[model samples]
Target chain A: MSDWAQLKQALISGDGEELCRRVRQTLDQGVSAKDILNQALIPAMDVVGERMENEDMFIPEVLMAAKAMSAAVEILKPLLAADDLSAAGKVVIGTVKGDLHDIGKNLVAMMMESAGFEVKDLGVDVAPETFVAAARDNGAQLVCLSALLTTTMPMMKETVAALESSGLRDKVKVMVGGAPVTRAFAASINADGYAPDAGSAAKLAKSLVQ
Target chain B: MKSKGRRGGIYRPLTQDQVETIHDAALTILERVGFTYESGLDDLLEMLEGSGARVDREKARIAFPRSLVEAQTAKAPNRVILYGRSEDSHLDLQDDLVHLGTGGAAIKIVDPENGTARPSTLKDVYDLARLVDKLDNIHFYLRPCIPTDIPEAAYDVNVFYACFKGTRKHVMAGVNNEKSFHDVLELAALLADGMDALKARPFFSIITSFAISPLKFCTQSTRIMREANRHGIPVALSCAPMAGSTSPITMAGTLAQIHAEQLAGITVCQLTQPGAPVLYGGIPGMANLKTMGYLGGAVECGMMNAAIHQMAAHVGVPNYNSAGLSDAKIPDAQAGWEKALTIVLAAMGGSNYVHHAAGMLESMLAVAYEQFVIDDEIIGMSCKVLEGIPVDADRLALEVIESVGPGGNFMTSPHTMAHLHDEYFEGNGITDRKSRPKWEKDGAADAWARARRLVERLLSGEETPYISESLDRQIRERFEILL
Candidate 1:
C-alpha cells in the first residue's frame, strides 16, 4: 500500500506507535511535514468526527483516535510551524473553580482534539484569570468553560467577566456547559453558546470559531 | 414458590435471614418510632387508640402493638383486582405480577414541535395518554404530568378527565384535597353509571402519600387514605425517604425505615377498612452527597428498590416502586443508560407496580412525548427478559438441528417458521434496527428524533377517547374541566 493509505489505516485503527513510525518513515522518504499533516492526519480526524456524528464511533474510540493523532503530532511538532499544524481552530478549555469534576471537561477536550482542534486544557478547579491568561497567551479563538455544580455556575460568569476585563473577551468567543448549565444560564452569563454534552460541545466549539 | 410471571431465586437481593431481620427491625421501629401527626386524624387516632393502638393525643403519636399490627396486616388481601374501564384490561396485583407503567407528576414536556423544554399543558397529558393507550408493553396509565395551565382547585378533576379521555387502561392519580377527591369519585361514578357501579369495578385507584420520611404522617394524606378506604378503594401510601438526608445512610438502614413506613401505612389502611386493598409503597432512594439532591440514576436506588420488592413479597402484599428515570436534562445516552439499569433491576426483582417507568427526565421534573414512545420500546425489551429461556422438548429443536446439519440453512426450515414470532420480540420503534444507509436516508434521526416522529404520527391519527360523549359533556358541565 502507498504511504498515505498506510498512515490513514494506522490512524483509523488507533495504532499510536504505528502512526508515529509511519510519520517518521514518510518524512525520511521525502514527504513534507505539512503534507503528512494535511494529507493524512487531518483528513483521518475529519472522517472520525463524521463517524461520531453518525453514531458509528463512540467516546472511547474517539479518545483512542485522539491519542494516536497526538502521538503522530508529537513527531511533526518540531518540523512544522504552529500555523501549518491544525485547521480546526485553537480552543482553551477549563472547569471553573470549586468544581472538582474533571471527567466531563476531559471528554470535551479529548473530543475537540480528535475533531482536529488545537486545545489547551487547564485542568479542574481552574481560576477565572487562568482561563483569560491561557486564551491570551495561546492566542486562542475559542474558550470553553464547564461547571458541574450549581454553586460553581456563578464562577462561570466570573470567568467570562475576567475574560472581558482582561480585554480578551471580544477577541475569543466563549462557550459554557455542564450538568447544571442551561442555555438560559449561558445567556444570563453572556456566553456565546451552550451545549448539553461533550459531543455537542465539540460541534458547538467548531461552529463558534467558524 | 415461584409465581407465574415473576422470575425469582436468581435476582433475590435479601436472603431469608436478612428479610426476617429487616422485618423484625421494621416492627420494632413501628412500635417505638410510631408516626407523628399534626391534625385531621384527631378522631381516627381516638378510634385506633380504642382499638388497642397506644395513641398520645397531645403530641400525636400512634404506636401499634405487634399483635394489632400483624392482625391488621393479615386483613389485607394478597391480591386485588384493579380494573380498567374495559374488563379485559384489569390488572391482578398479585404475587409479584411485575406490571410496568408511567408515573411522576412532572410539570414540563419537551414541546414536540420545536424540541424545546416548556411547561406541560393539558394537551400534553391528553396526547401522552393516547400514546400510552397504543403501547402494548406499558400495562397501565398513571398521571405522567401536571397541567400547569389549570387552576389548583380544579387540577385533580381536569387531569383525571384528560387521563380518562386518553385511555381505557386503569388510571391512577393523587387528588388535591378532600373536596376534589370526592369530585373525582363523582366523575368516575358518572362514567361507571352510579356509585354502586363505580365501587363494583372501580376503574381507577388513589395514591395517598400518608407517610412522611423520618416516621411521620401528613394529616391531609391520612384523611384521604381514610376516605378512600370508606369507599372501598385501593390506595398506595407512597413514602419516599431520600437516604443520607431523610433516612439512614446505609442501604440496610434505609430499607428498614422505608419498610417500617410501609407497615405504618398498611396498619392505618387496614384498620380503617378491613379487607381494603393496600400496596406496599416503598420508594427509598439515595440523595447525591455532592449536591444534596435526589438522584434517580443512583445504582443504590435500583438495588434498594429491588430489595424492597423482596421484602414486600415476604410481607405478602403487592409492591409499588419507581424506576426508569434519568437525571439528565435531555433524552441522551446518560438518560438511556440510567433508565436501562434501573428498569431491568426493578422489573426483574418483581416490582408489582413500577411507576415512573416511562417519560421521566431531569430527575423527575420533566417528561417528553418522544421519551414516552422511546421508553415504551425500552420497557418492551426489558419485559422480554422476564420470559425466561424455555427449555423443553420443542424449544431444544434437536430434530430440526440434525435435519439442517452442516452447511444447511435453517432460515427456510419449518421449525424456524414455527416458533420465530413467539421466541423473538420484533424490534423497532425509536430503537433503531435499520441499516446505516436506510437510517441516514430516514433523516438520520437520533432516538429523540425518531421518538418525536413517532409522537407526531401517533397524535395525528384518529382520536380514541374511551369516554362516551354524553358523560364527557356532563363531566365538563358539572365541573370546571380545563381541556
Candidate 2:
C-alpha cells in the first residue's frame, strides 16, 4: 500500500515502532508535515476514538493505540516545526487550584492535539492567575479549565473573574469542564463552552476556534 | 453550636431527634394524609389489602401497621456481608459505613469507533466486573447499565447476570423482576447446592429499589420484592427521589417524603411475609431547578443520605444510600473533589450501606470507565477514614518517633516498615504512582487508559466467582424459558 495507508494502519493497530519510523520516513520524503499529521495521524486517532465511543475497542486498546500515534507525532514534531507548519489554534488547559486530578485535562489535551490544536497544559493546582497568564503568553484563543471537586467549582468562577479582570476575557473564550460542571454551570460562570469528555471536547474546541 | 437556617443550600444539619421527627412526620403522612397515585403504585393498594393492611381501596390510601414496620426493620441486618456468587464474593459491611457501586448499563447500543461512549456489550460487562473486583472500597457493584446491547425489557436482568459472573464475593445489585429474580435464585440455589457438603454458604442476594416521595411502589418492582421476601432473601428498599420531581424541594421535605415511603415499604414487606428482611434504603437525588437536571453528589444528597442512615439506625434497620457519586464528568479535579467530600462525609455519618462507588457522571445518566478508577481511590480514602485514627501503642510509635525524631529519615526504619502496612494508605489501585518523568516516558497516561489496563488485568488474572457448569447451564435455560 501507499505510505499514507501504511501510516494510517500503524495508527489504528497501535504499532509504535512502525509509527515512529514511517513518520520520520514521510518527513524525509519531503511529504508536507501538516498533511502527514492532519490527513494521516489525526484521522487515525479519530478512527480509534470512534471505535472507543462505539465500544468496538475498550480503553486499554485505545490507550495503546493513542500511544503509537503519540510516538509518531513525536517523530514528526521537529520536522513540522522546521516546515513552519503551525497548529490550527493555541489553547490552555488544566484542572483548577486545590485539585490534584489531571486525567480529564490530559484527555482533553490529547484529543485537542489530535484535533490539531497546540495545547499548553498548565498542570494541576493551577491558580486562576496562572491560567490567565498562560492564555495571554501562549496567545491562546480558548482557555479550558477543569475541576473535579464540588468545593472548587467556585474557583472556576474565580478563574473566569481573573480572566475578565485581566482584560483577556474578551480576546479569549473560556471553557469549563469536569464532572460537576454542567452547561448551565458554564453559562452561570460565564464560560464560553463546556463539553463532558475528551471526544466531545475535541469537537467543542474545533467549533470554538472556527 | 446550633447554626440556624440552611447551612448547605438544600440541606440543614439535624439532630437525631430531628431526623426521627422527620421520619415520624413522613410515616404519619403515609398512613393518614396518603400519597398520589402514580402510573404503577395502584397495585400497592391491592398488595396492601393482600397483606392485611387497612387499605381505603376506593381512594387507594393505606394505613400501615407501625409494629409491622418495626418488625421488618428489626429483621434487616444491622450489617451483613454481601457474598459474591462464588467463594470469592464477600465483603463484610462493618456497621460503620456504606459501600458504593457503579451503574449497570441503562441503555446499550452498537459499539462506536472511539474508545469512549461506545455501545456496551457483554465484553463491557466483563470489563466492568474486573474493574469492580479490583475496587476494595467499592464493596458493592450496581449492575452497570448497558441498554444498547440487550432489549430494553431484558436490560436489567441481563446486566445483573453479567455482573453476577464478574464478582465472586460482593453482592451484585441484580434486577428486581419476577423472572430475573427467580432465575437469580436458581443460580444461587445451584451455587449453594454443594455448599451443604462443604459447610460453605451461597453467594449473592437480591436488592430491589422503590420509588419514594409520593409514597408508593412500582407494580413490577413491588412484585419482585414480594417474591424476594417470600424466598427469605435480603431486600434493599432503595427509594431514589429526584428532589423537586418526586420529592419536595427542601431537603427536610425530601427526607420526610423518603422516610414515609421507606416505612411504607417496610410495612408492605412485613405484611407480605411476616419477619421478611428489608433494608431501610434510599438513593435520593437533588433536582437542579434551573436545568431540571438531577444532581446526585450535591451536598444535600450527602446530608440526606446521612439522615436516612441515622433514621434507619433508629428503627434498628440497616441503611442503604447513594455515596461516592460525583456530578463531574471524567476523573478530574472536580470529580475527585466532590467524591472526596461525599465519601468522607457519608462514612463518618454512620451510614451502614452506600451505593454509586464508581462509574457515574452527568447526573448519573452515563458512566465513565476512568471515573470508576478515581472513585475507587476516593473510596480507599474513605475506608481509611472509616478505619479511624489507630490508637494502639504501636500506632503511637514513640520509639520510632524518637529514633527518627531528630533528623533521621523514617523510610528505612524497622518501625516504619512495621507500621507502614497498617498505618500508611496505599491508595485505591487507580492512582498514578510514577513520577512526572516516568509518566512522560510512558506516554503521559490518563485514568481511562489506566482503568482499562486494570480492568483487562483483573479479567485475565483474577478468577471471578462462577457457578458450576451444570448450574450455569441451568441458569441460562431458566432465563431462556422462564424469563
Worst 10 residues of 2 chain B by lDDT: B1-10
* Cα displacement (Å) at residue B477, model 1: 2.3
Task: Report, to 2 decimal places, the DockQ of model 2.
Answer: 0.01
Q: Report the poorest 10 consecutive residues by lDDT, candidate 1 chain B.
A: B1-10
DockQ for every model, please. 0.02, 0.01
How would the docking of model 2 be graded?
A: incorrect
Write the residue-wise lDDT of candidate 1 on B165-210 in tens digits: 9999889999967887899999999999999999988889999998
Query: Interface RMSD values for the candidates, listed in order?
Result: 12.0, 13.6
Q: How much is the lDDT of residue B7 in candidate 2?
A: 13
Model 1 pairs whose backbones collide: none
Question: Whole-model lDDT, candidate 2?
Answer: 0.68
